[model samples]
Target: MVKSGQVSRQAGNNLASVMSRSVAKDVYTAIIEFVTNSYDADALIVKVQYNSIDDTLIIEDDGTGMDQEGIRNFYRIGDSEKIRNPFTAKGRRKIGKFGIGTTLLEYLAERYVMETWKDGKKITVREKFEGMGKGKGPEAVIEDDPGHISGTKITCRGTRFSKTGLDISALKKVLEWQVPCLPDFTVYVNRKPVSKRNLAASCIEYAFDEVIKDLGNVSGSIFYNKNDSEPLKATGIFIYVFGRSVGNPQGFYHLLPPSTVNRVVGMISADGLDDEISFDRGGFKQDSVKYHAVKKFISGVLESIIQDITYSKQKEPPRDKTDEIKEGIAIALKSAESELNKSLVNADGNINKNHPYRLELLLDEEIPWISRIDPKNNVIYINAYNPQLVVYSSKTNPTSALNVVFLTLAINALAEDQVGANNGNSDLFKRFAQTRMEVAKRLFSNFTPIGHYLKQQQGNDEQKAIAVSDVRLNPYRLYSIEDAAKLFGRDIDAVTRLYMAGTLRSCVKRRGIDRFRQEDILSCMSKIEGYIEIGSVSDILFPSDHESEGAAKHVLVNKIIDSRGNKPEYLKNVGSIAPLYFVKANNVEEFKRWYNGVE
Candidate 1:
């Protein structure tokens, strides 16, 4: 029969355990750890001094020092007494579990001296490790003093490095990196207060603060350096938890795109990550759930920072009329999709599933970048503040100038997919200038215009898509069939179907183009219509590399039928027209409910 009892380590085992964690290469870590111990002891000011002549390093703190019994407790290695109640008497947050700082003294020098005073009594200890002798445990010399100051002073002598002891400059840098900013506490080296570098203030930063569903808040600012200076090269995202650096800085780069990592630097601070700290306080326990949660949140914020950085590149506002020029480009881009799709899409037709459509006109003076393709989000970001574009905006049509830039970007989107598909080994872009020009010529010869969008606002109408107008009762301006789709946020396919089904009646029809009143387009868009394209729906729920379109559609269709007990409705000429299954849903959740077979 066995009974529960006090668990304990045999003599010298605890000391051996702590010494095993002490790294010989970095004696500075031990110094930082002891300084941290001082901070935990509610030290307001810690002073460090080193004598090059004697090779002696001393750290003294005005803190709640310990007596003879307390000195004995310090050797009780694994049993960190402060951890039982990890806060000071005045309620300062303590650096918990208290780092095993003293064991490192043995690695740094042959002799260690400690003097402390508490409760009107004093104790002095001169200690040595068996590792430097024929012993297996620590050997110590103890003495009792009548009185002393209320603080602890540690002295390390008998240098390990016989040649030119530690450099002050190098020591300061190491401590700055290892030690965190203690609240209301200061550390001094040779009477000079050592301060941390202000890496965030060195560059223009984008600040962000977000809470993950009221769980906890993470705040940070991301910095960008266009210069690629050597000083900034070593920088990336750094995370802090409880005033201590966590994980690794390089770990942040692994979570972002390759293009965004080079010039990015950030500092993130989060709370509630204490449980993840390792037994030795070397770093956080990477496999801990808290660490993963914090990382996942930071990953989302980094994506936004990337977008902001890209936009920040544009320094001039759009000299051209933004909406009109965008409308013209929108028309040109639609006409050029087939050419772009040859490269932008795969055979399975999975990527860019939502669209190779839509261009966002955010050409402000504060914005930068002539053209940027976000193929993942299916957006083409452009800075339309160009002289040529401004000149063309005055014309009844700006298709020429607009297509010159927009079509080129569309091709770049295609190249992105092609390059990605070929595993990045194609020499198609070797003679970049000639190849691009030739490709542009071939794609442009087949281009055609779709509609008009440059017009003043008109009277409001309650409903649209009600009936065909006589071009007279038109309170809304006329728009091309393509323009109607663009203005109302409907896809070209959606607008076309609504038109064919007589829900969107065009007032003017001439030469292959049908023009609709804005009122009618509005009504059509306002109609509660929902669609589920197999590839599109698959992209929605399972964004990453996921199930095949056919397999996904079968499951979705069965789910809808079984749950709603109603067969899905398909458009007439579904095979010839767009491959979409329709359902009646007034809201997004309702549409998702229909597709997912959820009530």
Candidate 2:
């Protein structure tokens, strides 16, 4: 026989018991969710303070303060009212769904407190986990404080953090990497603002804005003119990384390659018509986002962008627009796929093979209307700029998307191959790596510069540079059957038959011949494309172990003769390429004679 209030207390205990378990997973995830909510609220300033020693965390945001009803709707568990409205003053679509982020703090800590205000009214909610549970301690307080500012302050006490100590460096790195775009926002640890190296400027901040303005497509503009004395205005893309604003993206184009470090192949942003790109778990799977919604959102922005691009090409007639539109569509699709893949991919480089996605052209309009790539993670980021979808890819090619997917797969496969390539190394794996790097380089070169820079900064500078170089090489450009046959010392029919039968090796033999063919033996011809191959010729020249003298005398001579000194700058810029080429070609004698100035 329990008293009436005791019976109610029993039910409350059960609810509190379950609530405790609810916040059990990753603590950082809770922090991320709260920060995301702040971003969605158009909060320009979000301060996060945490002390591992005390196991305490504090998050403050200068976003639109929530009143009593708003707090009730937002703070109350299982509330969906905020998401249902679907519109913020900042034009950010909602991402929060369960309204359980607040409880998560308490789950991680012994006590959680939230103080917020809206329309001059302030409210506070405090929860404690001691007695309200089955055998636990006491009750928590949820209040409304009139003196609170027009913002929200979340404080956690007695928090159980995973790490032994506060990893301020690692935390700063993560935050900087995660929110590279929102430079105006700041993150501080122990009252000290974390510093990050700014990476690159957004393309939208570059000529893209000018392009947009020139095209007169000002439907939902996000870029604003800055008073900075810089010649270029800020494009809508966010290129800052680790609390530092990225340098001009254009400067990186020639210096970095996509496959190197963390490459910024391009910048993209969604137009105002879609949900903001932020980490949230509503309307998406756990720890993931809805792929279709994202795609539709991106497609709408792309369609609008294509309109601007088309208008830029005013000299072109409508008769030729079909092919042009197809080209643009292909570019957009590839970029979209790449961006989505990279965003959802994990550090382990594993991809869910069974990713759900679909794309459809909007009424033969040459622009895809509905595009969706379902993510397994429930986190969706609500971005401030919903239009002008910015997409990054290996270049704007249909194959780039496939490459991104396959590249992740290959990374996993290679990791497995490393265990089994005990028979020395996997020839197939090497070829695959080479091919993938080549493709990645090409993509990075044409797509944008950030990816290349990222890769370089991550220490694979040489490899990434090669990849960027290959972008312009058009390695896919091969001679016609007839031309190839001639170069292989065979007839067209024989070459075609051999190629079809996959027996080209039998048809074309290279035994003890320094040159693959007579054309290969000839002096360098003056062709613009030759410059690309010449630039990449180093891979074929000099040995990895050759001394500088041996390299210069052997490789440099042949390149000069082969290139006919067509590009004099190569003499200074890539002298190594010249020397290496001659040495590897077994043209040492020819090189020596030329170098010695002998007839």
Candidate 3:
């Protein structure tokens, strides 16, 4: 029941020429091919050693060695039994289909020695090649090596390694990427073990598999580098046929964009792709329909995985220390309130029940002060005019603004407690005021109007730089009134009123411009009850007396006339010097209507 095919002598000679001409593209690739052969042989441990002194590379493995018939089959180029039966006797898929791997030794060295033992029999073979370009084959000799055990050892001499010898570190990385996940199996180079555990630790992996109608089972893992700065050197999806790696890492050009190439690495195994692979077993045949189908599927899967990663990152909460800050401030506020309440009492010796101490937080468009503690009313008011508070409150979680409120209340409570202890000593009060202002500046530095306003002057190099440096040193440093106005979104006159009220303590006057301390601004911010409209008398009305005494009265009367215009219904004499008009201050809606009709 045996059948055989024969080739002519000329054809055999031509085949030898083809084998001699074909060689591996690189030394590392040639080495990978030989190692992959050992894996197909069901090797448990593969040892590789390079001798720089002699330029020799030795690869040995503890696998099922070949018999005499197997040796003959190995020598037959392009006629491997693996092509007919794609799986080994152990049921493991084979990586080498063509017998070309055996001929790859010619590309690595000029001379080589191979020894193997099987079934109590041993064989030692030696080969010497003239040169690759000569089209001449290796001269071989066979002998018995009875001392050899049940394994295979290949020693390649006169290797074409670089002048400094092999780069063991780089070679180890290549092996780690090319080798599949083999349980209880390890590869050692120069007695050092190469491990995949480190690579796995630095990646986020996801497992995926899809069954295509003509492609059998397609399965693989996608890995994204957790740290982009230190990515794997050979990053891409490594394609495997059977249990061995075939071709260089692929899927870079097709799977993802160029920007993400360094951050992604993967491995895919498609057993049915064996038939569609090239003769050299390096890659799939481009014209094969099965190749395109598998590529398309892998591309789709990779795109989905990338989208999932992006979505997860977007949903992750931003890292911050605001929660810790808020908690500390809350504790401080409670302690300050408790200390201040002890000293605050009525004349009857009982704790003040009518004017109970409380903290009030408010947001007003017209408020000019940062904060105020009223001992008479026992109320602590904080202004929402602070730019820091506005920015923080607008966040998805308004913890930043809440922190400002707690801190401001604590500062005000402490100042009130200090004032009660001092009993109105001017010197002691000044010291207490100084201390309170310093504390407020430090606590609400980021929330201050001046702080936010100065940030907007980024175009002014000298001023912005000085402000930044001062803030870094002490957040409560004095700023000019104009800067404060810009920060509070108020006019200069309103800010000046705060300065005159003594709530805003002046630090120093420079070039006739007063520089108010940040702490003083916060203290005076609460003292501002209402805004006064200040201007010249003529500006307030169209017609007014030029004389000083009656100038104010005439301005007021003209204001009323201008407000009413020349409406005949409201005027008794249309063009007379004295006109009668009716007004209603109680009806706010009616007053607004008349005001709208005014000149």
Question: Which residue pairs show collisions in model 3?
Answer: 369-525, 370-525, 563-598
Best by lDDT: 3
Point out the higher-scoring one by TM-score: 1 or 2: 1
**Global lDDT of each candidate:** 0.56, 0.41, 0.58
How does residue 412 of candidate 3 score in lDDT?
52
Best by TM-score: 3
TM-scores of the candidates are 0.47, 0.36, 0.50
What would the per-residue lDDT of candidate 1 be over residues 412-483, giving only the tens digit for each residue? 545654674567633444345346444544654444212223212111121222222321222323456655
Candidate 1 runs further than 4 Å off: 1-18, 21-25, 132-147, 161-167, 200-202, 208-215, 225-234, 255-264, 315-599
How are the candidates ranked when ordered by lDDT, highest leading? 3, 1, 2
Candidate 2, residue 91: the lDDT equals: 68
Best first by TM-score, ranked = 3, 1, 2
- Which should have the higher lDDT, number 2 or number 3? 3
TM-score, candidate 3, is: 0.50
